[model samples]
Target: MASLPEGALMQRAAAGLAYAVIGHLRGRGLGGVYGKRVVLLVGSGDNGGDALYAGAILARRGVQVEAWLLADRAHSGGVAALRAAGGGVVKLSEGYRSLSGSQPSVVVDGIVGIGGKPGLRPDAEEALAMLAGVPVVSVDTPSGVCVDTGEIDGAHVTADLTVTFGSHKPCHLLDPAASACGTVQLVDIGLRLPKPVIESLEAADVADLVPRPAPDGHKYTRGVVGLRVGSATYPGAALLAVSGANTGLAGMVRYVGTASEWVKRHNPEVVGDGQAQAWVVGSGSADGANSALAFARASGVPLVIDADSLRALNGPLGVPAILTPHAGELAALIREDRGDVEARPLHYARLAAKRFDAVVLLKGRRTTIASPDPDTPVRVNTTGTSWLATAGSGDVLGGLIGSLLAAGLAPIDAASAGAWLHGTAATLASAGGPVTASGVAAAIPAVIRSLPAVSS
Candidate 1:
């Protein structure tokens, strides 16, 4: 803002806000923008100023715009511009009685912005309660959310759409706060930002990261992934893990477990035992998890550790590895409460990554992959449906990531890209319905096919 002329940034923000509100108006089929009622819940800061300026632009387009000032004072220049553009201005205190039966087509929530704390004032709450069912367009972020923590502490506006400038905030990606922000639209405001320490992968990023086969590649050249998973007590775990690895990401899969007969019965192509570039251990090896982990460690190759194998950790494994754990397993490893781990996944995941000297993939709605290197950014995956919380899913994830590791990707890249593919496969399998772990595994090839093809 210091680089630009005074009010230039504000003008750009107002124009973007106006454009988004107009889009909502057209999308709703609300008699086109002209003469539609739009009420601005103006507060006492630059947030209110942005709304007032946007209201002025709408008023010039023949919109019936009104500014309801939540505080005794508001942006002086914004108020002047609104009045000049023939928009109505009134203090909410003076007009509270007249708002009972009045209904505006849209409400612009300029009541709070990124600078505000995590709750609302009494009067702001009352205004929101009065206008309960109307569609809202929040400027920047929804009011009354912890801007940096993605937590909702008190009464807040649930916007139908949120218009953010420059970049996305934490509330846009994490849960609770993410649920409140219905659809986020980011507008470029021409600010050069520093490199971020947190990021979410889009399809293109995954496309570039996933390894492809060479035209002349033979079976051994492509790479082989081995599994030391499952037991007689949980044979299904072995089958599911093999299902994930056989999706053709790796050249071949080798199974060595108590459930070898069952795995071969389900997946005939899997070999009994052989050398491998990477190993997946401990999904359901039960009492044998420790031995399985030790055997895989002896190979001096990359490993994907999950389920029962997660408890076998004493220190760093002295090899490239990825640790897959849910909130409960992570809690046990760190000696913290499961609820605490869930609430603060970023902190705990980073801590575990540093402690274990490996990539830690913590599973949740927004699955976070934290790298052991301090300079590497934490990757957050924003795909998949809630239906993915089915049984044996983590087994499939473990095998899939192990395959990527065997194919020569770094541990962090393999883990993040594998996670992105896992979630996306679950979404495609679910299709707004219930999905099984087997169905998710089956959908992996289709998901890979959907990605843009890049040269090997």
Candidate 2:
């Protein structure tokens, strides 16, 4: 509406969608749209209007367009346009059995729009079930997906293509629902929308955010990330966490644990305990995790909380911090069921961030980074393969994020950028094979080097 007259924008949406549908049908070896079977699931609102008009355009070219009105009424003008162009309309009750026999070339889902809630009505569900195998193109958003939250409560349309206007919605960037939107295409209808609240960082963005050393810089001057992790019982945790901190994101790494000598043996550059710009605690701190976290918190600098340390700080973090936890750990932290958190990551992650007033980095194949502010958009990282879910992978991530924090980035930037790098490293290290946590940590420097350099 900002760019064109009220009705004109809708027309542009219809035209662009029509082209996409035609292209899809042609790709499927349907020859062309002419005389092909096209079915539309139409609601009563503007969503129905877009589908009705697009169907009308295809109908004029000899496509057999049949629109099933799911609502009590149809878009009057749109219905008239379709009838004028030789398209047929029927109620949903009359659609199911007929569509099952037609072998539709494509199905257009226009039963719901962005503002509608999650899950489909029973009639809509039955209609979708009747034409289960047919290709579906959604208007604006897939029917029944929560456009803002990406949280699905019940049945929803899994679209083969989603043609949106203005810009992509939260569902396009978020997961669960994102998985349902097969391929998304943005159609420019000359409408200028507001700035996107959520975003995912790419390689170039990471390169820009990474701290560069000055010519006059010394090791400490650049930044030192100190680790107060590990125990006699689990010394390997300190080694893995130190491995992550040694990615060269920070100038220097420090260790303050029972495995100080052991950590230095693995990476000699890592020195004994000392003051650091930032601290990473709890990875393997075991029984002493609570004491170590208290010590780090007393330093009054930012810290990365992971593993045992996370268990230590069960209450509000009370300091500038990054909270890294996998699904099970995050579930424990919030006292929610593990299966529930796994099912709804964004919901639980945001809850943790707001509850603790810190940056929460929920670890998974599709990692979610949420800031403490309620209005800030959450970032989703889809960089690594499923194989990256191996054990000790998160300890490496905690240290890497700690290094970024010591380098003076805000908690959110530090957490998100570190996650991006960590995931990218896993992908590079894997090379189509299984990769261990140490191998992923070892690959970090190469990933950093491969990134696009910032122009002076």
lDDT by residue (tens digit), candidate 1, 1-456: 587999988889999999999999998987689888899999999989999999999999999888999988999989999999999899886556656655788999999899999989999998888778999999999999887767777888899999998888878776667778888999898877778777888888999987788889977887899999999889999999999898998988999999888889888889978799999999988999999999999999999999999998978999999999999999999899998888677788899999999999999988889999999988888889999999999999999999999988999999999999999999999999999999999999999999986755
Deviation of model 1 at 244, angstroms: 1.2
Listed per model in order, the count of residue pairs whose N, CA or C atoms clash below 3 Å is 0, 2
Clash pairs, model 1 backbone: none
lDDT of 2: 0.88
For all candidates in order, the CA lDDT equals 0.90, 0.88
lDDT of 1 at 298: 97
